[model samples]
Target: METVVDGTGRAGRSGRRWRITSMQVLCALLVLAILGQDLLREAFDAPVLQTAATVFVAICVQALPFLVLGVLLSGAIAAFVPARALRRVLPRRDSAAVGVAGMSGVVLAGCECASVPVARRLIGQGVAPAAALAFLLAAPAVNPIVLVSTAVAFPGEPAMVAARFAGSLATALIMGWLWLRWGKLEWIAERALRRLPDTEGRDRWRVFAETARADLVDAAGFLVLGALVAAVFGVVIPGDWFSSLGEQIVLGILVMAVLAVVLSLCSEADAFVAASLSALPLLPRLVFLVVGPAIDAKLFALQAGTFGRAFALRFAPVTFVVAIGCGVAAGLLFLGGVR
Candidate 1:
């Protein structure tokens, strides 16, 4: 009876292992099937597929340097800047802190990918969640690099740059205030709330390198996914659709907002993409700029991972609404009715 029981247990274990191996093999085959470009092209015989692959590579190449810079900066901040020192520099009042945080984004130039970890670090270091959240939203949108890129992209229209900056700043400030008033403490992940241990000298450098490496690997996967999505849509959407929607301003705005979320373009390169959409009015493009940096597929996933699902669920939706409103208001004030 004992021998029979042991035999049954071994069979069960072997069967489980075999199932796992089969699943792994199936997944690998599926991935290979998709990546089989020549076979795919021969089967579908579509030029759009080729164009999409080109666009995907182009977007990824264009955004890589900025993403590297962002990750390095994030790592540096994590390693060298003591949370206590940061807290000492900022105001104690939540409102005041929010203001300072928004303005600070001008100096801490980074893409949205970099800001999530830094914001988590800030929160762990005892900074107010509202202030950290404000900084997270503002850094990518209002930074000098992003602003300059906007200026360069929309060359004869300085108003676009101003509108983008104003809309982003206002969105960040409003989100901060909203969090201050209503954000609950329990929404943040326990992991995000815990502070890192203080280190010195060589250890700091080690921490910097390790943190940057991990951030790069983690962010790169999502960045690639975003680029792939953008590329696919770029080819799938007909060119005339943009021109057709130009007449309907409200529809243009809503579509651009949704595109911003779906595309997940890096803030530095997004200006160029927005500029390329010449069919749309500047107002909708401005909405794209403001919304992209604040809440996109990549940003949403990172926020959920770093801050808690509950926080992202509430925060991302509110930010989307606030950002759309601010974009329109800024467009009116700066672009003078978006001609």
Candidate 2:
């Protein structure tokens, strides 16, 4: 009887493993099938494909510089900066720190995924949890690389680029300020947030290696999830569906926000998606791209993993409303011509 019970347990475990493996295989096959379809190959023959390729490449090229810089800066911060020094430098007042920290994105250039380790490091370094949170929220959208790629993607519409940057900054600043004022920092932080190494400095190379490796491992799941959803959206949705919905910016923004939750696109690459949204008004798409880095389905997963699930539920909606508002205002101020 005992032997039979053991056999049943083994079978159950095997079945579970098989199910997981089967799902992974199915996901891979789906990705390949979509790539094989005209949605991907059509780019080779169609001028629109050329535009898509241009947007993708430009986004990648533009983003790499910022990714490199942010990673390096994070490494340096980890290596040389002590927790006490950081705490002393950082304002304990959440509103002030969060507002100022949101603007720090102008200095660090990284996509949403790349920003995680840097944010974790900042939190670990005792830079006020609110400030670290702000950096995580703002770093991806408010960077030069994103700005440039967006400008190039929306050629002839320079205002779209400006709106994206300005809107992102405004939303991030507001959220950061709020986080400082009311955000439960303790609930979000892991035990590492409190640990202080006796050593003030570590070897730079070692710090870089450790941070990059740890971050990639920890955050790669979110990236894969984001990429999978983006790929799926490219395959499943007709490129012009948003255009068919009409020229209403508010409606389009709402729809895009829903789509953002599903697609989980990296902020660096989202402008390409936004540019492809030819039918959606410029402001709505800009809002979509700006808001996405802070609150997407996969990014929510990443946040839950990094901080806690409780934090994400409260944080996401607040950021979403603020982002859309910023985008709308930016549009009115800069894109009156965009219907």
Query: Which runs of model 1 end up more than 4 angstroms from their true locations?
Result: 1-65, 199-202, 214-235
Please write out the lDDT profile of model 1 over residues 168-209, one tens digit for every residue.
999999999999999998988788899865555458888889
Highest lDDT model number: 1
lDDT of 2 by residue, 107-174 (tens): 66665765665576677766777777787888878877677767766789888887777888888887
RMSD to true structure for each model, in Å: 5.2, 6.4
TM-score for each model: 0.77, 0.69
Prediction-by-prediction clash tally? 0, 0
Instruction: For model 2, name the residue pairs that clash.
Output: none
